[model samples]
Target: MNGLRVAVLSFAHEHAASYISLLHDRTDVELLTADPDFATAPADELRGRGFAARHGAAYVETYEEALAWGPDAVVICAENARHRDLVLAAAEVGAHVLCEKPLATRVEDAEAMVAACDAAGVVLMTAYPVRFSPEFATLRALVESGALGVVLGGTGTNNGKLPAGRSWFTDPELSGGGALADHVVHVADLLDALLGEEAVAVRAVTNRIVHGDDPRVRAETGGLVSITYAGGAEVTVDCSWSVPDGAPTWGGLTLQVVGTGGVVEIDPFGAHVGGVVAGGAEQAWLGLGENLDALMLEHFLGCVRTGSTPGPDGRAGLRSLRVVAAAQESVAAGGAVVRLTPSSAR
Candidate 1:
């Protein structure tokens, strides 16, 4: 088709900025953005028109206005709980979607979003930029090629500082859970893509001890989750918001995979030079490598134009959502094992 008309539905999530920045400069993309929820945002927070203007994208007053503009596709970056409504709205308008992660706060809502997009004959791609990392690609290649032999178990971590600008990240009602919800999905999605095996069980432990001093922080700030795949491979994920405020970067993800033949590890964000910059008050890390978000967006837009399915599609999102749901169930049961029935995994 001709140049694509795309709408960015909200700016609640931090990644929205990167996405807007990437799309704004693309000549083949006509970008429009809306954040009606911004009306109630704190005065100090950048949202709505100001955020859109800063990113050099066209702004609309509401999601309704943006959808009515007839976008061929949309990027939904709303709060976790708000994803369902935005996704249904986009699907109703027959617009392909690339939704922000943790898909939804609940499994039923995620299932509904997937079904709506399927019924509308529109693609629903989940935002999982980590899958686009070259380092991760190499890991997947090694695993697939039997260089790692039969996978036994592994340890993964997706840790970061508590989100600074967005209060919703700590609100369970808006963000789903906490560190578990915010960080688990990326590694879970990666494992799912790597193993292609159903997750048979999950056990998780979470605590609010990290930010317990803040009354507003009701959700968990630290967690450790263990998942068992159908093939008997167990993976433990430390999805915690444990990075200190003074850290040079927010945080990073790393995975150590152990198999029968050998072991492999990947640190997607490790390609960086860290030191104190000249005349700078604090330490700094200059990243080196391809931008995973740009690669992910390019893939999504390519699928949009070709009418092909996107990797980490709605079903992939649903699978990872189930893992989080199971993890929450396990947490509620005092970290007891929560077995996932095959039907539930689907």
Candidate 2:
């Protein structure tokens, strides 16, 4: 009921900047900051850009010390590989956690994170801000209300240009994988929210058609993953980073849902009216709609106050990641259909 005290864990994931913006803009949230290492890529963007000190919040050197301030929750913005330890530490300190998704590079760690949170009685929420996008909300409501009749399958795309500033995104060791790892979770979580079911099987394909010029890139720049939900509904997610630097609006989601009754299409970022200023100059279509990040922060804080279940809980993240892992496995197995096991289910 009172103001929500929050701490941001890391800025390794660029989305932390957006989360910082949302938490900063909120009057009901008292924010704090902690980045374990100041010499890494995250620190360069967060500290060099002065986002860490901009709000005048107390800054700590480690996540352990950040919890000393007694925050009700902490948003873990660390890399995919770092989520487990940060989440376990936060949950150990009796703080709810809101973690950036693709919860872990490995399903085992993800399951462990959820178990730790469950053991500590702290909610572990996976950040799925795309579900918070207002336009996306309406679409989910429509499909759930049976406006689409018998649901068939949906297509989701979250393609983007190379993560120019954040090089770790293309580093398999840091981000898990290229397009398949970085991009798959968003759509998987979307399907989780919209369909209210789990993906029973997955088949994926990954390639390096783009970003071949860079020797530093070890991850594929493009990927297409097909998911088969429990109810027999199917969907394809395009999590490619194939767009050019000059593409409009970084990258946006294009979702097309098909059903026996009719079809629904959504472009969450396209509602913003913008024109091309200079194609090659970088600033393309700018979003003028309501901010999804702000809405997500508000929701997370509200859930903390009410002790409500985090909408997309850690289990939900694990589910999405199971699909991602399956996709990755499928890619490795020559695009074979990967069957997930019950023990893997949360």
Q: Each prediction's Cα lDDT score?
A: 0.93, 0.83
Clash totals in order:
0, 0
The Cα RMSD of model 1 versus the native structure comes to 1.3
Residue-level lDDT of model 2, residues 187-298, one tens digit each, is 8888888888788889998899798888978999898899998888999998888887766667878889999989988888777666556554545465777887777777
At residue 311, what lDDT does model 1 achieve? 85
Where does model 2 exceed 4 Å of error? 42-51, 54-57, 278-284, 343-346
Quote model 1's TM-score. 0.98
Q: What is the lDDT of residue 138 in candidate 2?
A: 87
Number of the predicted model whose TM-score against the real structure is largest = 1
Task: Quote the positional error of residue 8 for candidate 2 in Å.
Answer: 0.5
Clashing pairs in 2: none
